[model samples]
Target chain A: MAYLDHAATTPMLPAALDAYATAARAIGNPSSLHAAGRSARRMVEESRERIAAVIGARPSEVIFTGGGTEADNLATKGVFWARRDADPGRRRVVVSAVEHHAVLDAVGWLGRHEGAEVTYLPVDGTGRVDPAGFAELVRAHGDETAVVSVQWANNEVGTVQPIAELAALAAGAGIPFHTDAVQAVGQVPVDFAGSGVAALTLTGHKLGGPVGVGALVLGRDVACTPLLHGGGQERDVRSGTLDTPGVVAFAVAVETTVRAREQYAERVAALRDELVRRVLAAVPDAIHNGDAEHRLPGNAHFSFPGCEGDALLLLLDAKGIYCSTGSACSAGVAQPSHVLLAMGADDARARSSLRFSLGHDSTEADLDALLAALPGAVERARRAGAWKTPR
Target chain B: MSGGVDSAVAAARAKDAGHDVTGVHLALARNPQTYRTGARGCCTLEDSRDARRAADVIGIPFYVWDMADEFHASVVDDFVDEYAAGRTPNPCLRCNEKIKFAAVLDRAVALGFDAVVTGHHARLGADGLLRRSVDLAKDQSYVLAVLTRAQLDRAVFPLGDSTKERVRAEAAERGLAVADKPDSHDICFIADGDTRGFLEGRLGSAPGDIVDGRTGARLGTHNGAYGYTIGQRKGLNLRVPAEDGRPRYVLSITPVTNTVTVGPREDLEVDTVTATRPIWHEASASVRCDVQLRAHGEVVPASVTVAAGELTARLETPARGVAAGQAIVAYRPDPGGDIVLGSATITAGTRESAHA
Candidate 1:
């Protein structure tokens, strides 16, 4: 059976797997002072240097984390808490509407339980946040703003936000800016220095690395309070005995994915473009979501009028074609997506939307299976209820 | 199909009859995820999952229909409006009438299923007559009185011939998860068995007067009238004791005037009731049948007269506290027990509060 749910989780690349296997066979804790430990510590630093070179960051800036979620949480809450503590008046957090739940939820928790006011900067239909709108919000709140977080590219609809423009605005105000670049790393050009964001989040798994290992790039000037306090690892921000094997594998995966970035993007984008074209031609009313030009090469999202996304997902699953309704985190809840709602979509359109993401193993055959299964599935789903007339 | 035990068994029995039977569970939850049964609900996610598991055990396919928006718009909203209008509405009757037999059945028929099935403890004869199930303790036809002929045409009940014990035994024999699942007894939506709390949360507490029926004197401050239904005895939080220090029952709820009337237990009995949304299984025949006002109420001998799509039932013995919103199911004696004819909503009640 074809596994099309790569956005949910991708198979590890051969290089990453080799790195993990090699590290897993090796002995010693990087923190220990013994010879074995010194060897492990050297391997970790070397892997860190390789990843730093690819992302255009210094080795000291990369703080290793558990995964994308932990990295996003640290970037959001850690930055907000640190800024708020330094200036008691900094009680506001600005976030883009299309942010992942890892950031959206962390910011929401700060607003709800920690007494920090949160303002969501609206996105256009393509899910891109206007830098001017974000600048206006920061200008209104000024120094009272704790932090601003926006994804470099949306994980679902894949609209690549103008991170450089947004960073410049936040930099002028001296408010720390963080961007979740998990989906953007291998799909587009993401240079830490060029982007000008203080902190950036990247996960290994999205780029064909092992799960449970990621890094948060923090500029030398930025100060972030740790969410989890323990043995003061990762420069006193994230504390845990580091997984040496996972780190090596993650770094290996990052370097390999980055090196093959241009070719892979072209191949995946061709497949995604065909998928969008075939889906639209077959299901005429299918509305493609996200930025037509600036979206990630592998992301294709569409809203089919008068059909529930769950129904479509199940039908596709029945034919052994695996995709997703939206973000996998909020799949079970039968509510229209909050991201779609914030993008000015009504409940019906939000409920009707589906996300089909391509990755390392994606092929033309996978798109053919989806194209063949969609028309019948949408028709049957529409027949099951009194469909809402399309807007 | 009625959602009682017998009809559920009947549906399963038919499925076991080697026909292409597809077992279905309707999603009546306004929000199925948060759908709770009052304190002990049966339409819960756990229950729906259990029902799906049962279908899986039977080697059949199951699906959860998104009937939330419709359930809220139809049954739940109707129930709130009924209470707000100073009338008691049988939510079970509304659910069965709309959700199970009509909405569920409608969807089932569209899915190309031969018929919709339930566990209703009522039987349909070869001549298409509605008869009570053999089980005397678990007859649910009282709540299923609103099923129309069109709905009944595609309806099937499996447990109509067996008692509740036999039904459980069959489910146990089949190793269904619901084999030992306790029967639900209260309103499903009220979590934590707090009806008043559910009402208060949904309908904000608008403090009002609890007036004495006798002297027309203002008794004490009470929460909104919607919190109290007819025949309720406790949670009145009354200030003064009755003349004889007897427990008071809620005699009426007036939403317009926003008043709750409380009186002695004697004010609870009623003799006559008028019903709207009447449905009959037999083609307009005069038949001597038993009537039950509530789910657990004893079958009372009654004379039912129909006029202008309304059913007026005059019981042989005056039943006390016949609230306006309860279901009135008609039953006829058969070898099994009483077969259900149809049901209606209690539109009016004759109270013994004439002295007031």
Candidate 2:
């Protein structure tokens, strides 16, 4: 199958795989005080420095965690907790409506179980959060606010949010700003120093690094209370036995993916434009789901009315051309994409959206395969959606 | 033509009978995602796709007319309102009456279809009267009781003469993907296995009191009385224990008072019921027949009387737990077995078990 769900995960690069294999051969936990442990610890520190260098963050700022989900939770809840502790009354959290469930569900938990209040700032139809509206909210609730978190780019609709502008508003309030830049790290230009955000999250799986490893870059001045307290790993913020192989692999992937991003993006964007053109020519009135200009170069989302996204996806899958309904995470739930709905897509449009994401590995042949299957797929899918009702 | 199993099969049969037929499946889900969530039923994406695929296999043109907004306005909203009013609503009957035969079928005729076909288990008489299907196990007359004659005139049911098993066999023979598809039993939208969860999710928590039916003593706190139906037994979460330790059954729900009354199972039984908006399958008036309250409910002998405003049914053997907001589908026996006389919504019923 021509896999197009790069938003979910990607194949690890040869360099990353070699880095992991080399690190895996070494023995000893980094925490132990013995010479073997010290040797392992050196490799981990070296990996951290490589990761920090590419993201323009200091070595001390990189805190390794389980993966994207953990990084998102720590950035969202840990920062909220830290801010709340610094000023006991700073209990409100501002998050964008288009956040991944890792961030969205954590904020929901805070609102539901914790005493903290959460305000979901609405996004425009393009899935871009209005920085002005966020500023208005921050100014209005400046007293109770703990932090403002908006993803760097949506995993589904792929609209890149104006994080620099959004973070500037939160920064003015002296509130920590965190962005889950999991999708944006390699695909788009990202600099921790340039973005001026207090903290940022990036995962390995989405950018050709092996799964189960990610990092949260905490700015020098940012003080986040540790979510996991143990042997004081990752600057005592996230304490766990380091996965040296995974960390090394992650650094290699980030370095290589970011370096080649420009050329890769140009190629994929051309193929994506063609995919959209041919899809529209085949299925007229098929609506694109996000802002055409602001969307990810690799992402092409369209809502084919009179057809269910799931059914269409399955049909495409049968043809060995795999895609997704909206996001891979919520594939089986059968609810209209909350992200699409928040972006002002009506129920029909939300139900009809199919996301086709590309990556460095994507090629013209993959696009051709998708285009070949799409026209007949849309027609059959629409026919299948029909219900014979009584007159 | 109602877009259902019986009608779908009838359309195929009619086509097989060498008649020109077009199959149409109405887009009745306000959002197909609601019903498709966790694979609910024939309302699912898979099912709709299956129906369309069957039409395609039969070499017929198929179309899906958007009736979602109308379905929500007519069926889903009414269902929530009825539950809020302390009554149990049958959404299937409402869909059959309001969307299937009435609304989409009207649109089908407008689009130049000779008639609408469904997979309903009810049969039509030689003189063109609606009757119960030959297969009693698959009879769906109860849900179709509310469909009007004018609506029925353009309706067809191919599965009426065949049993569900036969339908499956035929589906298998034709290589139809959904020929052996499992019959959908629950409400399509509420796939979380909790109607209360759906209500709570949509309507934010409304604090209410759960009280003992006899003493009026507060038994527990309920999120909303609107979430509880007349005969619901679960989710009471009562702090007070019954005398016999049996779970309490819902006896009444007073939305105005915001109170849910709970009592022993015996308190849920009802003997008599009055229904409104009756439609006859064979004639304009009433007759003696068997009434089934629920989809799987057994038929009980009853003398049915109908007027322009309402229909009164007095069971020969009093029924039990006959809650309000249920459809009263009547069935009369003929050469085909049982024919549907039509149906109405139950407005009131006796408080105790008439069967007991």
Candidate 3:
């Protein structure tokens, strides 16, 4: 199979797999204080240090959680709750329009059930939140704003946000800033201290690590509530027994991907650009989504004018090629992408878009297969008619 | 596959027939578990799992395609709109025609599938016609009649030749757990068996008069004309009885005037049923057919004619309780065959004595 859906989850690096296998054989709970426990504790701490060093975070700031969603929930709810407790009037949650459901839904829950006033900072046509637009929202409700969350990059459109500038704007307003860097870390430069954000989220699977492991790099000065409260590990922000094997593998994956990011981006981005070129060459009117210069090296999203993305995805899947559609179906009903809507595209365009993200294992050969299969799929899907949604 | 025994056995039969099959259980509702919808509703999470298990036992790929939006638009909304106009609409017929055959089948074909397969108890003849299921009790050709030539040409009903009893038996032999799963009944969208409440919630209450169709005298009042069906005997809450001491039955409902006309049992019988939206299997011409009104109701012999975009049928024997918006499926009844020839929606009907 030509697997170009790496942004969804890439294959685990072989070295990371080896690290997990080795750690799995060792039996010790990192929480316990026995000699065997101390050995596991050492492995967890060393992994923490390795991840922190690569991401430019303090080892103490990296709080491991089950995955990216958990880390995101902790950041939004924990920090928002803490900040609200510090001052009850600080109930405004400013999140970007293009955030993944992790941050979007968390902030939404706070607004709905917790009485938070949410101001969704809108993005430009290319799905980018200009620093000025974000700044205006924060300033308009600066005193009342408890938290500001703008993702490092959008997962769907692959438009990298101006995170440092946006984070600095929130900081200037004395508000807690959290960026979900899950998709950005391995593909871009993400430094907690360098970006000046209060906390950030990263997951292992997206960066070629094992699943069920991620971290929330939080500043020591930030007082946040806990999502889980059993072990009080990782500075008490999150509470769960450390998955030693997962942590070790995650650490290895993060270090390898981040270190190799520069050369990797150049190689993969060149191929992705060529893919965009060839796909457009095959289907003349196909529109590329997101800002061309500002997207991730591995990301190539397009909107075929008359095709249903899900139908196209499944059609290509039958031909041994894999990708993702921005639109997600619930009960056989496909909903147009909110990100594309925020980008000012109409509903049909939003529903027609698909994402093809390259990874470390992706090659020109994968591109060739996709290019060869795409035109026929698009033609068939168009003939199928834009997924007949309910009137 | 719907995770039921019929679909499960049908999938097994298709696979056994040396055809590559992918079992799919359509998620017809967004949140099936939230409603106390019972086994009748197709969208329950349990049903999806059952389909998955059947696929596993049969060693075929399975998927739950969410078609809730299409169903809601095509079938659910149509049910509400038809009732609001004081007509009894068959949601099953709408689902089969619009969602299952047109929408879902079209997508399957476009995705490279040669045919759309379902467990509906109907036969796809080699002549490209749909016939009745072998099991008359389990026959579903009434709803299947709405499908056109294109849909039937690319459709596969694997459970047609076999009886429901044998299908269940095959399912048991195949180790499919839903072998004894109860058949889905009634309108699937109307979960909880509260059709009145469901319609009330959507159309709301519109008070109107319930009058005797013969005397034109008001017999009682009704909460909403939309809630009443043709030939309904009970629940009218009439304050007075007929002069002949016989019970009253709803003869017709006029939505524009919000009036329901109730009369003696004789008024309910109609010898001639004129229907619109004439859909033909082939050409439009006069032919003798066994016409079925309800999906499980009786089929009476009728001579049907098609012309000027309308279909008119004269029943050999007067039939009662025929309602507008219900499908009138015509079946070609030969000595050894019952094939669905065509169908139309009942728009108007007259009593046998009216013309006499």
**Regarding DockQ, does 1 or 2 come out ahead?**
1
TM-score of chain A, all candidates: 0.96, 0.96, 0.98
- For model 2, residues B1-356, the per-residue Cα lDDT tens digits are 22234444566687897877766665555445523444353455555666677787777765455566678788888888888777889888888778777666655444335676777887764567676777877777777767777777787776777888787777667666666555666786565567888777766688988999978889989888878777778778888798789888888878788898888877766656788866655464767788888777877988888886788887887666676788888877666576677788888876444335
Query: Candidate 3's error at B277, in angstroms?
Result: 3.4
* lDDT measured at residue A285 in model 1 versus the true structure, 0 to 100: 89
Candidate 2 lDDT over A243-309, as tens digits, reads 9889889999998988898888888889889888888888898997787887788998899998878
The residue-by-residue lDDT of candidate 3 on B158-215, one tens digit each, is 8888888988888889899988888887667777778999999998889999998877
Interface CA RMSD of each prediction in angstroms = 5.6, 9.9, 3.3
Q: Which is the better candidate, 2 or 3, if ranked by DockQ? A: 3
Model 3 lDDT per residue over A229-248, tens place:
87788787778789999999
lDDT of model 1, residue A13? 96
The local lDDT score (0 to 100) that residue A356 gets in candidate 3 is 96
Best model per lDDT: 3
How many backbone clashes can be found in candidate 2?
38
* The candidate that achieves the highest DockQ relative to the unseen native structure: 3
DockQ of predictions, in order shown = 0.16, 0.05, 0.50
TM-score of each: 0.81, 0.60, 0.94
